[model samples]
Target: MPKVLVQFAHPAFSRSRVHRVLLKNCKQLEGVTVNDLYEQYPDLYIDVKREQELLLSHDILVLQHPFYWYSGPAIIKQWLDLVLEYNWAYGPKGYALLGKKMINAITCGSGHHAYTSEGHHQFPVSQFLLPFRQTALLCRMDYMPPFIVYGTHRMQQDAIEEEGLVYADILSGLASGRIRPEHYGGLEIINSLGHGAMS
Candidate 1:
């Protein structure tokens, strides 16, 4: 089984409905390390060496957070800026993260249709995630399609729990090698695999 690391970031976790459930599911699984950035670095100070070490030890990296302003929370950007160093993560001598796999696990308050070109956001969620893809590419990591939970604002408790199960199953699949990164080609989101598309 591949070791998985979940870099979770949420500025206001106490008031979060979707992320709390997702975090609970992730915590229950084995071989999945949930690194709560806000919880760990309340001061917003990231430990570069420790973060790099965590990356080096894990085979798959999952950036799990809420879709805030069409991007990740502040801590995620802070983590990326501080942990992914030039000489270690992406420069000539930066082969530390090469061949690793990465994916985003995000929740959007709006419905999936809102991300379409004709909708309110006026662009697909993928378009807003280009920077993440590019970062993975620069670090020589295989970037998989994101795992998204849309319409979170209107989701009831049962629906949220169902999504949590799906999230847990996805993590389990990734850890057990049942879900291959290459199988995600041409897919817009990793959630498709949960809908009987993985086979």
Candidate 2:
């Protein structure tokens, strides 16, 4: 089984509807570690050594956050900048994350159609996530397609709960090795597999 670490960042968690349930579901799993960034570092002070150690210990890294302004919240960038140092995460001697896997689990306010070229964003959500992919590549990690919950702005409570269940299923699959990294190849989004498909 893979040791999965979820770096969960939500600036306004109190106001969150989708991530709240998702977090709760992930917590119930056996081998998943949920690291709430804002909750851990409210003052924005990150422990680089500890973060690196966590990365070294985990097999899979999951970046879970709401898609803010086509990217993640400020803390996500801060964590990356402070924790992923030269000669540690990248460069010649930066092999701490080599062979590890990364996946973005993001919640979007708009529906999937809104991220298409003909829609409001005028680009796919995958395009906006290129930086994350490059970062994973630089660290020699396998960057998997993202798991997304679309149209959260108008999602009903039952629908959000269902998405939470799906999120749990995906995490469980990844941790248990039932869902391999190659399963995400050539895929735009993880949720397109639908609930229970990965398992």
Candidate 3:
């Protein structure tokens, strides 16, 4: 089984409706380590070394968070800045994450259409996440299409719960090696594999 690390960043999990529900079952998986950035670094002081070590110990990395203003929470950006060092994650000797895989699990306040050019947000959700993809690329990691929960504010309670359960299954699959990196190649929404493969 692959060791998976789920790095969750939520500026306000206490008052969150979608993110809190989505995180309900993430820590229950055996080989999946759930690291809540805000919970750990409430003071905004992230231990760079420890974070790098966690990355080295995991085969797959999941960045789970709510999409705020088309970007991740402040802590995630800070973590990325401090933990992913030039000599360790990118530069000449930065091969620590070369073959590892990365996936983004995000919740958007608007529906899928809101991300389109014809919609309110102006561009596709994928466009908003390109920076994350590029970061993984620079580190030589395999970045997968993100698992998304669209229309967060519009989703019914049952739908929100179902999405949360599906997220748990996604993490479980990654940890158990049931979900291959190639399986994400053609998927636009990673959650589509929720039913058949996740179960």
Candidate 4:
């Protein structure tokens, strides 16, 4: 089984109902590790060597965070800046993360339509994630399509639960080698994991 590490980063985790549910479900799985970035580094003092060692040990890396300003929070950017160094994650002699798999688990308050071409954002959310995608490429990791939970602000209890279940199943599937390679894309709720359109 793949050792999946979820790098969870939420500034106001106590106030997040949606992400709380998402994290709760995924945390129960056997081989999945939920590393709360905020709880670990409240002051954003990231341990680059420690983070690098965690990456080296895990087969799958999940970056779970709230979509702040159409991107990740400051801590995630800081983590990437300090942990994913030039000589360790890339460069001529570096390829320690070559075969690992990565994906972002983002929770957004906006509706799906709001991130389209004719919508307020005027483009797809995937289009805005090129830096992340290309960064994975630079490190030679298999960057899977992001796992998104949209419309979090208006979702009811049942809707939130359903999304949480799907999130759990996706992590479970990835760890157990059940989710296929072709299924990895900018998938909303991992529709490829056989849970129907939970988006």
Candidate 5:
């Protein structure tokens, strides 16, 4: 099975209802590592060497967080800016991350309609995620459309639980190569392992 790495960041995980549960579900699956950024680096002092090593070891990279102000939390951006450096994650000789796979698993407080052009946010969720997709592309990694949990503002217990299961199953399927090729069409990445879609 392909090893997975989830770079999880949430400023207020103690108060989070959705992300925490999702992390818990992922933790139960073997071969999936959830790296809690804030918990690991409370002082914002990231170990670049260790992080790079972690990236090299994992086949799939997952950025898991709650969508805050249409972007990620401050620390996740910090991690990207620092760890994905020159001659390392990007640039001429920076092929360390090349041909890898990346995807986001996020929770949105608003409904799906709120993210459309005719809705409140005035753009699609995919549009708001261009930066992330481009970053993955720049690193030569396949970028997959996010696994989104929408309508969190009024979600119930069962819905959150179901979404969590779906997220975990998706990760498991990616690692095990069970999801089919046809499902990869509008997807962001193709598993170089000849599995299915990128996780």
Candidate 6:
């Protein structure tokens, strides 16, 4: 089984309705390591060497968080800035992450329709995630589609649990390599439809 490192970032997990459950399910899964960024770096002082070491130990990396302001939380950006060094994750002699798998798992406040061109957001969710995709590409990593939970505000308890199960399944599949890279036209498309596979 592939070792998975989930870099979770959430400022208010206790008050969260969706992210908390999603993260909980991920923890229950085997071969998955949940790295709570906020918990580890409450002072915003991320240990660059430690983070890099964790990344090197995992075959797959999962950026699990809520979609805040059309992107990840500020800590995730900080992590990118500090941990993914030029000589390690990119540039010449920076092949530590090459050939590894990367994926995002997010919770959105709006429904699927809200992220469409005709919807309030005026662009697909994929458009908002291009930066993440490009980041993985720059590091020579395969970026898979995200496991998402839409309509978070309107989601009921049972619904959240169901999505949690799906999230767990996604983690399980990815860790076992059952969910191959680019298996669902990238994370944006896979998330747009709950079920993912080759058609």
Please tell me which predicted candidate would have the highest TM-score against the true structure: 2
lDDT of 5 by residue, 1-199 (tens): 6788999999999999888779999898778898999999999999999999999999889999999999899988989999999989888876799878888878899998998889999998888888999999999998876788889889998888877777877788766766533565575322222322244
Decreasing lDDT order of the candidates = 2, 1, 3, 4, 6, 5
Compute each candidate's TM-score over C-alphas. Answer: 0.96, 0.97, 0.96, 0.93, 0.91, 0.92
- For all candidates in order, the CA lDDT equals 0.91, 0.92, 0.88, 0.86, 0.83, 0.84
Model 2 lDDT tens row, 34-111? 999999999999988889999988999999999999999999999999998999989887578999999999999999
Candidate 5: Cα lDDT at 9: 95
User: How far in Å is the alpha carbon of 7 misplaced in model 1?
Assistant: 0.4
How far residue 93's Cα lies from its native spot in candidate 2, in Å, is: 1.9
State the RMSD for candidate 2. Answer: 1.0
> By TM-score, how accurate is candidate 4?
0.93
lDDT of 3 by residue, 46-133 (tens): 9998899999999999999999889998998999999999888989875789999998999999998888889999899999999999
Ranking by TM-score: 2, 3, 1, 4, 6, 5
- Would you give me the overall lDDT of model 2? 0.92
Off by over 4 Å in 1: 195-199
Tens digits of per-residue lDDT for model 1 on 58-149? Answer: 99999999999989999999999999999899898767899999999999999989998889999999999999999999999999989999
Q: How many backbone clashes does candidate 4 have?
A: 1
Better of 1 and 6 by lDDT: 1
| Model 3 misplacement above 4 A | 196-198
